[model samples]
Target: MRLWQRTMIRLARSRTITDFMHASRLMRPFSSRFVGGGDAGQAVATAQELAGEGIAASLFYLGEYVDSEKLVRENVDALLKAIPAMAAAGLPLHVSVDPTQIGSVLSWSLCRENAFRLARAVAEVARGGSHPARPALMLDMEDAGVNRETLQLYFTLRENDLPAAVTIQSYLHRSLDDLRDLAAEGAFVRLVKGAFAESPAIAHTVRSARNASFKAAVDVLFSQRARERGVYPALGTHDHRMIDYAGMVAQANGWRRQDWEIEMLYGVRPGYQRRLVQQGFRVRLYLPFGRSWWPYSIRRVGETPRNLAFVLRSMAGAAG
Candidate 1:
């Protein structure tokens, strides 16, 4: 990571900054730009609007790194309870699951049970939705630490005949091998250029290398053999270069736009997302909602210097 990003990350973790962000209402516009809303009801409303534009949604209830049993249950139950209503909207949808937030970091069995319950709920409701591509309960890949366990949870869900999907961080050196293995299983893989910071030894710390890794990942995920196995690749990126590269590869491999998907963040690059939809590509926005919004909002700013500058300028305007 660059010094500025490292510095911002450290700042994001501090008590003063966290508390300020949590309490300030000035972040409302910025939050709405990227976040779904402060609760599930509002999130569904946002998803409905996106649906009218020919896009879909993957709803994420944001609360990560839970430290207590009560918090874990709260996080799990919140999403579990929201599933049926979210499905009722008749939109192509997914509930994003972060294992660490639901006990993977502390207890494996507990996390598995929580995840299984959520995935099973999705499996039941997905059949009733109108969209042909079955909605999946997506397991988000957090840091490198818990990736294996997340993938295991996904397999367990699948083995039991539940609807499940998993994410792959292309920035990781081990991702190509992981993608190869997942392809054989016909796994639903959401591919991203990873957001977490890691050692340069294990992750591509620079953008060029990470971008290359991402393209290379697309080739593996969209390969003829993988497609034959019914592997579904959701390209989770906003980069035009990556999008174009994936489009080219998909066309060359004789895949239609509807066969795969382009996943973008709810608030980022709205114009580009619509353009892709108009071009007949299936697009889904990752929509996060909940009271625990500070952690997510700060990371978006830190992800790019331009985003950081924009937020800072917004803050200045708010102060004025």
Candidate 2:
């Protein structure tokens, strides 16, 4: 990572920076530009709006690192409510969640119970025909620290017959292996270039290498073995090059647009998303909502230097 990106990542994780940004009215507009809203109702409404534009959405309630059961329960409750709301709105939606946000950091048992509850709720919602497409319950991958536990939880969900999905970071060296294993299980997977700052020891620290890994991983996901086994892949990227490459790969493999999906953040590359949809590609927007958007917003800004203007405005607001 570049020095500026590394610095921004550290700041993104800092509570001091989070407080400053959250308090700055100047940041609200930028936040709303990316974040869906502050609650489930607003998020579902946003999803409905996107659906009207022929875009599917993956709704994420943005909070993580829960150290309390109360917070975990609250997260589950919100998801339970959101599932039905998205269905009622007739929006094509996938629900993404952080395991730690629901109690994975507290205890494995707590996390397991909470995950099962949310998955069961989603299953029930699907059965009711509220979400006819049977939108998946996806577990958003965190840093390397929780990788094993997150994967365990995902497989456990599948073992119990829950239609679950897990994310794999292409930057991580272990991701290739994880992809292979997930493919063997016919599990749904989302491939991202990774967002967290990490040591070069475990993750690809170079941009070119990471991009290469991403394409290689995509190839593995769409390999004949994986496809025949019914392993679905979701390509999460906004890079035009990567997007075009994915389309080329699909075409070469004679895969239909519905066989795989291109996932992008809700606010990033809107025009590209529209163009992809117009070209008969399946696209899903990652829509994050909730009051705990500070950390998430900071991470988004950290990932793209172009977003630094919002941070500068926030800092200026604080100084003034």
For each candidate in turn, the TM-score is: 0.95, 0.93
lDDT for each residue of candidate 1 in 145-213, tens digit (9 for 90 to 100): 888888888889999988899999999999999999999999999999998878898899998999999
lDDT scores in order: 0.85, 0.84
How much does each candidate deviate from the true structure in C-alpha RMSD?
1.6, 2.2
Put down candidate 2 lDDT per residue, 1-320, tens digits, no spaces.
Answer: 45766787677668788788778776776678689988999999888888888888988887788877888888888887898888788875479999888898889888889888888877877777745444688999988899999999999999999978999999999999999999998888999999888779999988899899999988888887888888888999988898788778767777678888989998887998999899988889999988777778767877878877766775576557
Clashing pairs in 1: none
**TM-score, model 1 to reference:** 0.95
Clash number for each model? 0, 0
| Angstrom error at residue 193, model 2 | 1.0
Q: Which stretches of candidate 1 lie over 4 Å from their true place?
A: 128-132
* Candidate 2 residue pairs that clash: none
The per-residue C-alpha lDDT of model 1 at residue 278 equals 88
